[model samples]
Target: MASSIHDLARHLNISIGTVSRALNGRADVNADTRQRVLE
Candidate 1:
């Protein structure tokens, strides 16, 4: 089953805002972190 941002964030042990930013490709997010999110 697919997970939502909240679930993903919890799984990754990161903040929901971080997940949102990473998924959105926001410049504020770290490149490595963004790549992890994309994958």
Candidate 2:
């Protein structure tokens, strides 16, 4: 399992900020992208 936001982001091929925003439920992140992060 991913140990940190950086790991998750790297695994998902997205930026750390994107993973953080998605996890935080920020509106700026696309719903599909957020769903990917959530999964």
Cα deviation of 6, candidate 2, in Å: 0.5
What lDDT score goes with residue 39 in model 1? 82
TM-score per candidate, in order?
Answer: 0.84, 0.89
Q: Which lDDT tens digits does candidate 2 get at residues 1-39?
A: 636999889999999999999999899999999999999
Clashing pairs in 2: none
Q: Tell me the lDDT of model 2 at 12.
A: 94
The prediction achieving the highest TM-score against the true structure is: 2
Clash count, predicted structure 1: 0
Runs of candidate 2 exceeding 4 Å displacement: none
Put down candidate 1 lDDT per residue, 1-39, tens digits, no spaces: 989999988888889999999988799999888887778
Misplaced by over 4 Å in model 1 are none
